[model samples]
Target: MTCVRPRRAARRTSRSANDSTALQALARAGYVASGVLHLLLGWLAVRLAFGSSGGNADQQGALRELADAPGGALLLWLTAVGFAGLALWQLTEAVAGVPGTDKAKQVGARAKAAAKAVLYGVLAGTAVRVATGSSGGGSEEGLTADLMRAPAGRWLVAVVGLVIVGVGVFHVVKGWRKSFRDDLRATGGGGVGQAVVRLGQVGYMAKGIALGVLGGLFVAAAVTADPEKAGGLDDALRTIREQPFGVVLLVATGLGIAAYGVYSFARARYARL
Candidate 1:
């Protein structure tokens, strides 16, 4: 019994160490992957803004662009691992809950963490698929079309749209209030820190606006009963192009997204991991 207990203790210690190392590595890599994606998306959006056909300015497009670069497949694999790690980390947070918070707050935080886990997990899977050269066609549009064909699918699509809009509003509020600062270990005082904060503010608002527009498209799809009207980030940006002074708006928004990418790099450095 004594020998068995010691062996179990040693195993537990080793497992804990491995977990810590894995979490730290994943957190850093995940942030970098996210930064790269945002940077690519911003670049594509900017090109589109300038009347250049840079192709889709979304996650899938970002992956495809990365694949075209040297050592792209390897990078995608790394990104996939990083995002998978991030998903696991978020899942851990969801399961363990944040430290030193009230019940309600903890529940909310955990829920958010769970949602993030799903997002990262899906992104990781997509990256893996792209890396493997087995990526298929427009899944989002097809999914929307399928949903619309279901009974009461229009209402379901509308609900999804409303939820997305709500999430966009949340991001806008988070930026406006600078509440995201809470997620950081430190936001130094002075010009550099203040600049970073401003960048975050603009980035968040821009992203929020884009999401809001995307949600509106979904709602429109539901109303028109035309799944073709609904789209993702790329489509959302294109819709923005159809508006007045859209190119200018797109360029500004794209710059904001690029700023967010910079902020993401900063986050990798100072995030409360």
Candidate 2:
């Protein structure tokens, strides 16, 4: 009884510490960092539309752009800290239950949070690597290639593609239904709030479209027994560039992504801790 009590007390202490003000602040700042990265990627996508891209239209490309900016090194360090904080918060959420939710819903939500924690942790690691002069070599193409060489690699790649497609669809639905509101505090209805909602809807849908296309590429790669077909955001953007009215579609998608970035800044302020 005494040992069990102490262990329970330790868990409570850890949970309490996880909700610290500074950690929440850093987690919120992580949203801003995400916004910056999205904005840069959108800009790169727009540049692609004009046939004058200076870099890849993806997260790593965004990181490279950030590193080249004034005081970028310090900014990258801060972003790394912020992303780590966000990852920690997600991990905490995955471990702890939110009040009032049903058990099944809570389980599903926690699982999703756990997935987000992994993604945020990976982003944090990438930022740290870039800040320390590491190129952080590893592309989706290379990953697909490695998987191809392994047993049941093609099936694994197809599954990954399907998972990405599912995620993209989920994002689109979340934005369309404004389900993200559940994650925020009481944000009153007003011009600004409506604007944020609109921006989010556009942003999520655009991002979904891009991800959907990218995932399709992977699926195609697996079905055709070719690894060269799989690539990242840049490749996806290039694919969009080859379609009819491609310029217009690409520009609109880029603007939507930038809008999403702006919405993320608002989310940082209104999101529930």
Candidate 3:
């Protein structure tokens, strides 16, 4: 009887240890997956922006290019895998309620909600555009033109653009105050200092500013009833193409976006669940 009791106790202890180990492994996997998703999304953004479509036309061109480019294909695959991993991680985290997780969970939920809203909005807009028989196919200007041709469409487009820009600005600001400092500290590797960090922060702000400007221009153009005045990155590119430094600007912007992808990769790899 004494021997049997001792064996039973040992088995219970081992089972507890196994359970704990499994829980930890699950957590680690979850965090890694989230990071990977972020990286893939970032890559997708870059591919769409810089492909032959001039990163301006949000159409099937980018997807086709991604399918063709070996590197882009790999990134796309990775992105999908990463998204799955992130979803799993977020689900686990939500269930476990990890420490200091409330804010992250809330933010994540909001992001998902916002993304769904955008998706629905885009679909609805596309339907309207198709139904109305607008001329502009995929170009930002074309989208604006299509919308503007309708009686109340211009205001709607402006509102959507403004809302998008506002959301982007919020991400930039929140990301800077919370995640930016930590990311800089992690990536600085001695070469980065306070000034460098500040510059990076400014760069994030600049990105937000660019988005905001693009949004405002979209709104203004709509209000003026002139889609030609709707200036976006595509317009910027077109304007630059006529200038002496066109190639230089194009290359610079392309490289900058690529660098951003790398940054996103790093962020995903190191993010704690």
**TM, every model:** 0.90, 0.93, 0.50
Instruction: Identify the runs in model 1 with alpha carbons over 4 angstroms from their true place.
Output: 1-19
**RMSD (CA, Å), each prediction:** 4.6, 2.1, 11.6
Query: Comparing candidate 1 with candidate 2, which one achieves the higher TM-score?
Result: 2
User: How many clashing pairs does model 2 include?
Assistant: 0
Q: For candidate 1, what is the TM-score?
A: 0.90
Please write out the lDDT profile of model 1 over residues 20-126, one tens digit for every residue. 86686787789888888888888999988888776688898889899999999899999999899888877777766655568879889889888998999989998
Query: Backbone clashes per model, in order?
Result: 0, 0, 2
Return the TM-score for candidate 3, rounded to 2 decimals.
0.50
Per-residue lDDT of candidate 3, residues 1-273 (tens digit)? 999888677556533533464543543443343333323333434444444444332223233334455675554444334443334433343333333436747666545534643443343343234333443346667878888778888888888678857965965684377446553325545654444444445445534544565676677776787787776554543443445765554444434333434444444444433
Clashing pairs in 1: none
lDDT of 1: 0.85
Ranking 1 against 3 by lDDT, winner: 1
What 10-residue stretch in candidate 3 is worst by lDDT? 55-64
Candidate 2: lDDT over CA atoms?
0.85
